[model samples]
Target: MKNRSFALSTALVCALTLAGCGVLPGGSQKTTVDVWLMQGSVSGEFLERFTSEYEKEHPSVELEVTFQQWTGIGKKVMAALESDDAPEVIEVGNTQVARYAESDALRDLTLESVRDLGSEEWLPGLAEPGSINGSQYGIPWYAANRVVIYNKDLFAAAGITEPPKDRAEWLEISEKLDGNGRQGIYLSGQDWYTLAGFVWDEGGELAVERGGNWEGALHTEAALRGMAFYQELQSHGDGPKDADEVTPPQAEVFAKGDVGQIIAVPSAVPAIEKANPALKGKLGFFPVPGKTLEAPGAVFIGGSDLIVPEKADHRAAAVEVVTALASERWQTELALTMNYVPNKTTLAGVIEGNEGTAAMAAGAARGRATPNSPQWAAVEADNPIKPYMTAVLQGQDPARAARAASERITAALRP
Candidate 1:
C-alpha cells in the first residue's frame, strides 16, 4: 500500500512559511529560503548576483543559493523531496523535470500564474516537457542550442571563404581546412546530442508519437540516412576518431586554436577566450548547416528549468523567486550575460546583431528538445546504443548499428 503518512502530514502545511523552520547552510538564519541549482550550469556570478539582488531588493526575505553536481542530481532531488528540508526552489534539466512532475513531487503551475510570470514567450518545445497532462510543473530558466564555432583564421589560411552553406559544402570546407597540423573539426565520440541534429536534418526524429504512445525512430530510412551522414562527417574530418575524441569534448580542443570547427554551445565562447586570447577575433560562429542549406539547422536545445518542490516550506517566497527568476528581466539578462538562448523566442531580439550570439539565437529558433518520456531518463541512463553508435563512427556498418540501436531503444521505451 502507498505510504499516506507524508501526504497526511502535508495537509497540515497550510500557508507554510520558512520562518522558524529551515536554516541556511553554515549559518542559522531561520527565514532564509534555500535554492538548489546544478553546478556548472550557470555562471556563478550571475547566480550569486541574483541572490544578492533579491536579498537587497527584499532585505527582509533572504535567498540562500546552493549548487549540486550534474551527476546523480535526480537521485539527490528524489531523496531530498522525501525529507521535510528540501530546498524551496530547484533548477533541473528540462529533460529530467518530467520524472518529478509525474511523481507529484513538484508544484503545479497554473496558466494564470504562467501569464503572471511573463512566461507567455517561453519556448514551447522546452515548456511542453515540463508540463504534464495539462499543468505546468516547471518553468524554463534558460536554454542553449548547438552552434558551429569555427576558427576564422583556419578557414582563411585554408583558402576557404565563408562558412559552409550546405551539408556537402560543410564537409568540403572541413576537408580543405585539414592536414596542415590542425583538424578540420573534431567530432566527439559517443555524443548523441550532437549527432541527433543530423537525424532531424534528414527528416528523422529521435522518437515519434502514435496512438497515444512513443517509440524510437532511429531505424527509419530517413533516420538511417541521417546517421549515415553523421558517420561520413567523422570519416571525412581530420580529427581524433570516435574513441580518442570522446573525452574533453571537441569544444576544449577547439579552444586551443587548432581545430577548424566544432558544434558547441554559446558558453564555449568564454572557455575559448580564456584558453587562448589570441583566438578572440579569430573565432567565428554559425548555426550548423543542414541538407537544405539553412543557416541554422535543427539543433538540440540543452539547458535546465526552475521548479518549486512540493515539500517547500516557504511556498510564497519560493513562488516569488520562481516568478522573479522567470521574469522577463532575469530571463533576458540570463541569455545576454551567459550567452545562452533565453526561455523565450521573443528575446531573440536581444541577442541579435552579433554574428556569434545571433547564430545561436537562430539555432534556438529551429531547435528541438529530447524525447519527453518518463522512461527516457532510464533510456539515457542505460544507453545500450552508445557502443553501436561508436562502432558506426569507427567504421562499423551504419545501417546495422542503427537497426540494432533502434531495436534496443524500442525495447527500452516499452512498458
Candidate 2:
C-alpha cells in the first residue's frame, strides 16, 4: 500500500508540475487525467508513445500515468476509491471489475459501451465479467486463454491430418498418438482451470448464485460429468495426480519432446521453444475441443479491463482516454507490440499471421471467467477445486469430494 500510495503521490506532483506549465495563452488550465495501469501490462515505449500522441492531439489536456504492481492491488484500489482524490481511470483484471463495482466505486459505462464503444463487437469473455446485473462498469481491454498446443510430427505420425473439432475426436486422436513411449497429452490432474472448461462444456458451473448468494455447483450432475471427462482425458498422459501443472513446470515437461499436446496459454510457446530449440517450428495449436462442433470449448479468459472511478474529477476526459486506448488503432498497436489478443473479436485479424496468438484469439471468443463474486478471490486463495480434482483422479468418490469441496467453496463465497 505504501508503494502504491507513493506512486500516486509522485504522479500527482508531476501532474501538477505539467499543469502549471500547460496553461493556454487564453489563461485556461489544462485538464489532467490521472490513470493507473498495471506495471507489466504495457511497455515503457508504448506508454511514452501514447502520452506523446494524446497530449499533442489535445493541447488542453495533460496525461498523468502511474504504474502499479498486481500485489495487494485490491486493498490499494479500494483505498483509492474511498479517497477524495481517486484516479480518473484505473485498469483492473477483467474478473475483478465486479468486486470494485460492488462498492459503487466505478462509474456505469453501459451507455458509452453501446453508444461509442460498439459493445456488440467486444469479446464476451472480457465483456461479460465487466458487466454486472445489466450495466457495464469495466471496459474490455485485452484477453488470453488456453489452447491445445500439439506437436506437428506427433500428429503426422499418428496419421492425423487435422485438429479435432469436438471432444470425441480430440480423445480418439490423442489415444492414437499415445503409444510408443510418448504421452498423448500432458494434462495435469489438478489443472482446475482446464477442468472448468470441461465442466462448462457439460453445462455445469463452478458456482451458482441464488437469491444473491453463491454456492458451489460442482456436485451437480452436469458438473460431475465434466469432472468425469477430465478423468478420462488424464488417463491419456502420465501427469502427476496430486500436483497442478506448475509443480515441476509443465512447459519444461512438454519441452522434453515426447508429449503430443498440452492445454496452455499461447504465451507458453516461447518458454517451450527456449527450453527445447528443436520444437521451434514443430509446435502447432488449435482451440480446445468442445462437446459439439458448433463452437470451441469454453475457456477461462484472463485479461485486464479499464474502469473509471465514480469519484473522479474529470470523468469525461477519462472516458476519452479510455476510448482511445481501447480503440482499433491502439488495440492493434497493443496486440502487435505486446503479443496480446485485442479487446474485440473484430480485431482478431490483426494477429492473423501469428499462429499462436491467432489460435488464442479464436478460443477467446468462447471464453468465460470464473464466478463473478468479490469474495471469489477468497475462494481462489484457498481453492478446494485443486484438491477435489486430485482426489477424483486418485480414485476417491467424486461425489463425496465434490460435496466437501463445494461446501468449502460455498462458505468462502459468503460475505
Candidate 3:
C-alpha cells in the first residue's frame, strides 16, 4: 500500500509541474529580437518609444533591450557572442568598431540588400570608421565632437573680450584667466580622448600604417611637444593640477564659476545648462584653436555604431532594424531627441532648429576618427604620455620631458 501511494504522489507532482509550464491560450508566441545598448542619458525613454513604434509597424516582432555601462560593453558583447546568446543588434563605440570588425564576429552589411537603402547618404567622414577593408560592417547612428566651451560671464568678469583664434592666443587667455581662485582651463588628466586632440593639433599621428605594418607614433617629437604644452598649463596653474579633478563630478567646478574655459563634447552642454541655468546665454562655443590656418586643431569623434552579431538567430530581422536606423527619418528623430549628430548629411538641417545642435554639428563636420587598427587598444592602455604629461605640468623641463616620453613610446612600440 505504501509503494502504491508513492507512485500516485509522483504522478501528481508531474501533473502539477506540467500544468505550471504557462502557455498562451492559443499556444503561440511572437518572435523576440534582442538589442544591447549602453546605459546612460540616451538609452532610457528614447529606446522605449523607439521600440514601441517599431513593434507597431511589425506586429510579428518583439524587442528585448539590455542596457550596460559604457566601460563594460566590450566585454559583455564578447561574452554574449561566445555563448551563442548574442543580441541581434548592439551598440559599439566608434573607436572600438574597427577591432570588432576585424574579429569576424560582426556581420558584413555591405551587400545590396542593406546598401540599396542609401548608405552613401551618410556624411563623408562620419561613417568611414565603421567601414573596414571596403566592406561596411556597422552603421553610425549618432556622433559627438569636441569643441571649445567657455564661460562668457567668467571671461567678461576677467576682462577678456574675444575667443582665442590661435595657439599662442589660447595660452595667453589661459594665463590671463588664471588666479583669483579661478582656473584658466580644465582638462581630465588621464582622458585619452581629450589628450588625442592636443596631439593631433601638434601634428602628431597616433599611429601610421605602412605596408600592413602598424607603428606607434606617440613617441615622436610632435606628441612630446603636445604633452609638454599641456603640462605647462598645469604647472602655471592655468589648468587643473590633479587629473581626477578635471572631469564630470568635478565638472561642477565650472558651474561654480571657478573655471574660465574647457574643451568638451556636445553631450556635456545639457549638463552644463542644468547645473547653472542662469549661465545659459553666457556659454559660448568655437572650433578648437590651431597654430596656423592650414593646421586646424583636431577634435576627437566618438559615437555609437550599430552591429549585427554573427551568432544572432534573426539575420533578416536584424537587417531590417539596421535599415530602419540608417533611414533619414529615423536618424533625424534620434538626433533631435538625443542631441546626437545624424550620420546623414542631408538631415543636417534637423539640428539647425537650435543653436547648440547647430554648433555641435558644425564641429562634428571637421572632426577626425580615431585610428582604425586592432593594436590601438594596447597603445591606449600602456601609453607613457600621461605620466610624462604630469611631470611636465609639475614644472619639469619641457624639452627633456618630451624627449623622454618619446623614447618610452618608441620602446613600447618596438616589436
Candidate 4:
C-alpha cells in the first residue's frame, strides 16, 4: 500500500505557502528540510550559496543538504524510500523516475508543477519521464547530453575543415581520420547510450508498451539497422569491444591525444585538458551528427530530477526546496556555473557563447531517455544490451544475439 498518510497535511501547507515558509505557533520552531543531492551535480560553492540564500529567504526553514555517490545509488534510493525517514527531496537521474515512482513512495507533484512551476516550459526529455500516468512525480532540473568532442589538430591534419552535417559525411570523414596510429573515434562497444541515440534516429525504441505490458524492441528491423551502424562506427576506433567507455575512462583515453573524436558531455573537456594541458586550445565541439542534415543525432539526455518522498518528515518544505532549485533563477545559475543545459528550451540563450554547451543544447532539442518502464531500472541492473553488443561485435549472429537480449529484456520488464 502507498504511504500517503502525510499527503493531506503536506499538500495543504504547500498550497497555502508556496514560497517555502512554514507557520508555527509564535514562529519559533524551524522546519529542517533535508535534501539529498547527487555528488558532483553541483560544486560546493553553489550548494553553500544556495543553502545560505535559501535559509536567509525562508527564516522559518532550515536546509540540510547531503551529497550521495552514483555508485549503487539505485539500491540506496530504494532502501531510503522504504525507510520512514527518507530525505524530503532527492536528486535522481531523469530516467530513473518511473522506476522510483513505481514504489508509490514519491509524492505526486502534478498540482505543484502546474500551479507553481511552468510545466509547459520543461524540456520533454526530462519532463516526459517525470510524468507517469498523467501525474508529475519528478521535477525537471538541469540537463546534459553527448556531443562530438574532437581534437582540432587531428581534424586539420586530416584535411577536414568542417564538422560533418550528417552521418554519411561523418562516417566518410571518420574513415579518413582513422589512419596513422590514431583512431577516428574512441567509441566503446558497450556504450549502449550512444547506440540508443542511433536506434532513436532510426525510429526504433528500446522498448515499447503494449496493452499495459512492456516488451523489448531491440530485435526489430530498425533496431538492427541501428546496431549495424554502431558496429560500423566502432570499427573506425580501437575501443574495447567488451567494455564500456568508463571501463578505461574515455576522457583519459581521449587525453592521450591519439583519438580524433569521442562522444561525451562537453564537461569532459576540462578533464581532457587537465590530463594533457597542451591540447587546451585544440579542442572543438559539434552536435553528434544525425542521419540527415536536418537535425542532430538524438542523444540520451543525462540530468537530474527532483522528487519528494511520500513519507518525508517535512514534505511541504521539500516541495519548496525543489521549486526553488528548479526555478528559473537557480536554473540559470546552475547552467552558468555547471555548464549544463537549462531545464527549459526557452532558457537556451543563457548558455550563449559557450560552444560546448551550445552543441549540447542543440542536441538536447532531439534528446531521448531510456525506456519508461518501471522495470527498466532492473533491466539496467543486469543489462543484456551490453552483452548483446559485445556478442555482435565478436562475430556472433546479430539476429540471434538481439533475440536473446530482447527476451531477457522482456523477462526483466515483467513484474
Candidate 5:
C-alpha cells in the first residue's frame, strides 16, 4: 500500500511542476484536471489528440493526462484516494467499480455538472457495475468482450463455411479441425473469462448472493452443467491440459493456420494484422456460440470506467472531461483506432463494416459484468476457481472440485 502511495506522490510531483501555475490568457487560474488512464486501453496518439481537442473546446480548462500501468492499478488508486493530492479523474477497471464506489471514494454523478450525462447511452450491463445504490459513481468508457476469432484458412480446410452457431456445432467443428498435425480451438486451463461466458449462457453463475451473504455459485446445477461442457472441451481440445495455454502473438498463432480458432477480444485485430500480415484476408470473427445454435451467448464485459474523486478540487472540470471522452465522436475514434466496443448504442452500427466489428458490437449488446461485490476482488486475486476447472479437466470429479472451490470462494466473500 505504501508503495502505491509513494508512486502517486511521485506522479503528483511531476503533474504539479509541469503545470507550474498554468493560467488563462485573461490572468484567471486555468482549472487543471489531473487525469489518470490505463496504459493499454487507449493509445498515446489518441490521448494526445483528446487533450488537444478538449483544450480547444474548453479554453478555461487543461487536462494533465498521465498513463498508468495496469499491473496493480486498483491498489494505487485506492491509496491515492486517501491523499490530499489525488488525481481529479481516473480510469478504473470495471471490476473495481463496486469496491471504490461502495467505499465512498468517488463523487456521485448526480452532482449538477455531471447529472445530465444521459446514462441511457451506455450499455446497461456495463453501467450496472458502477452504480452505488441508485446513482452512478463511474461512467463506462471503452469495452472489449470475448468472441470466436478464427483463421479462415483453417475453417475452409476443415470444410467449415460459417462460424459455429451452437455448442454442438462448435464441438463438431473443433473435432474436425484437430487432426493431421494441427490443433483446434485453443482453450486455456485457467481462463475464467471465457469459461464464465459458457456458464452464463447456460444459466450458471460464478457467484450468487442469498440472505445478504455472497457465496460461490459454481456448484449450482446450472453452473455444473456449464462446467461439464468446459471440462469436455478442455480435455478434448488442442492445448496443454496440465498447464495454462501459451501461444505466440495472436496473429502469429493464427497465421500458422493450423490452430483453428480461439476466444479473444476484437481489439486483437490490429495487433494480429501487424504480427502476421499474411493473415489479413484469412481471419474472421463471430460472437461466442451459445447453448442454442441460433444465437450468440452472453459475453463477459471488460473495460475501464471514468470516475471523479469526491474531494477533487476541480470536480466540474473533471466531469466535463468525462463527458467529452464519452461523446460520440471520441467513442467512434476509439472504435476506429483500437477496435474497442463503443459505449453508446447509437455508435454500435458505426463499426459494422467487418464481421469482427459486427461480432464485437453484438457481444457488447449482451455483455454481462461480474457480480458487484467489493470482496470479489480478493476472491479473484486468490484465484480459487481456476484450480477447480483444472482439476475437472484432469479427470477429477467436477462436483467435488466445485464444492471445494465454492467453500474457498464463500470464505473470501465474507467480510
Candidate 6:
C-alpha cells in the first residue's frame, strides 16, 4: 500500500511538469503587433515608453516598432506588402497617403470606427487629406503649414512697424527691406511647396478633375501670375535663387539675420529659436499673403499620417494601433513633442498655447490639399514651371513663361 501511494504521487508530479512545459490543453502565448514609424519627427524614448505602458495594459499583445528614413518609406512599405510581411501599422506622409489610397493599398477605415474616436476633434484641415472618396484611409498624426517668419529686429531696422497683411503690402514691404547687404525676404526659388503657395493664392489649381479624369492645371493664368510673382521676388534679391541655397541646406544665412522675412514651416521654428535664442521674443508669424485674391491663400499640408496596409496579417491589431495614435491624448502629446499640428480636435489647446502655432494652424485650417491623382509624379516631372519660374525671376516675360509651362503641363496630363 505504501509503494502504491508513492507511485501515485510521482505520477501526479510528472503530469504537472508536462503541463508546465505546454502539454496543457488550453495554454498559449500572447500575440505581437509590428509597427513602422518615421524617425526624424518622433522621438525614440517617447515611443519606447508608450509601448511599454501599452503592453502593461494589454498583456496578450506585444508591439515591435521599427524606424526608417522619411524619403524611401513608401517604397519600403510597398516591397514589404508584396512579400506579405508588411508592418501591421505604418506612419506615412500626408501627400503620399492619397497615392496609396488611390491604389487601394490601404484598408478602408469605416466612419463607425472613427466616429466616437473623436479623430476629427482636432483642427479640421489636418483631417482633410486623409479623406479619399468620402472614406478615411489614414489618420493624421501631425501637420505643419506655411507662416511668414520674420526677424523683428531686421524689420524694425528697416523702419517697418508691422508685418504685411496683404499681397500688395507684402511686395511693397519686400522692396522697402531689399538691398544694403540684407534681403527683404529669404525664400528658396526651387521649393515646390513654397512655390505652390503663390499658385494657390493666385487661384491656380495644381491639378483639377474634369470629365471624370484628372488634368494638370499648373499652366493656368493664375499659375503664371503666381510664378511671375515668385520670380519677381528672386530677381529683387528677396530670396535664394536655386534649390541648393534653400533654407535647410544653408540655414546659416537666415540664422545670421541676412534675410528679413521667410515663408517658413513650423518644423523650422524650433531650429530658428534654438539657433538665435536672442531673437525668440522678436520673431513674428502671419499667413501667406494673396496676389489678386483678397483673402490669404492656401498652403500645402505638410506632415505625417498613419496607414494600415491591405496585406498586413494583423489587420485588427493594426487598426487598434492607429486608433491609439490618433487618440486625443496621443495626438496632443505628439503636437507638443513634435511642434506640428494635431489631427484630433480636442488637442487644439496644446497647439494654441503659442501664438505662432495658433496662427499657422488657423491658416492651415483654410488651406487646400495637393492634387490627389496618381499621375502627379508625371505631371510634376514634365512641368516646366520651375525653370520658367527661374527665367521669369531673371526678367523673362511672364506671358511667355506661362504659355510655355501651360503647354508642357497640358501635354503631360494627356492620357
Q: Each candidate: what lDDT?
A: 0.75, 0.90, 0.69, 0.90, 0.78, 0.69
Give the runs in model 2 whose Cα sits over 4 Å from its true position. 1-28
Question: For model 4, what is the error of residue 300's alpha carbon versus the real structure, in angstroms, after optimal superposition?
Answer: 0.9
Give candidate 4's total backbone clashes. Answer: 0
Task: Report clash pairs, candidate 3.
Answer: none
Model 6: ten consecutive residues of lowest lDDT = 1-10
Evaluated at residue 236, the lDDT of candidate 3 is 31
**Cα lDDT tens digits for candidate 3, 1-415:** 0112112332343365553322222544455677776776364566767777887998777666766777866777777766676779888887787778766888888883244556776654457778888888778778877777788887898788887777788888888888888888876565556667678778886666767766556667787676766655544344444454344554476666678877776556677778988777788876677666544466677788888988898977987887787677788788888878888656778988765566667656656676677556666677666666666666777567656765655444444
Q: Residue 261: error of model 4 in Å?
A: 0.6
TM-score of 1: 0.83
- Over 328-413, each residue of candidate 6 has an lDDT whose tens digit, in order, gives 77777777776667775455578777777766776666565666655565666655656666666666776776667666765665
* Best of the candidates, TM-score: 2
Off by over 4 Å in 1: 1-32, 56-60, 112-114, 118-120, 179-182, 209-213, 255-258, 269-278, 293-295, 353-355, 394-396
Q: Clashing pairs in model 5?
A: none
Candidate 3 deviant stretches above 4 angstroms: 1-30, 41-43, 112-114, 117-126, 158-162, 165-169, 179-181, 188-191, 228-237, 241-250, 269-281, 291-296, 395-415
Q: TM-scores of the models, in the given order?
A: 0.83, 0.93, 0.79, 0.90, 0.89, 0.82
lDDT of model 1 at residue 193?
78
Q: Lowest lDDT 10-mer window, candidate 4?
A: 1-10
Q: Candidates 1 and 4: which is better by TM-score? A: 4
Tens digits of per-residue lDDT for model 5, 18-137: 644554334556676888888777777787788788888887776776778988887888887877878889999887888888768788885532456567777755787878667888
- What local lDDT does model 4 show for residue 353? 85
Better-scoring candidate (TM-score), 2 or 5? 2
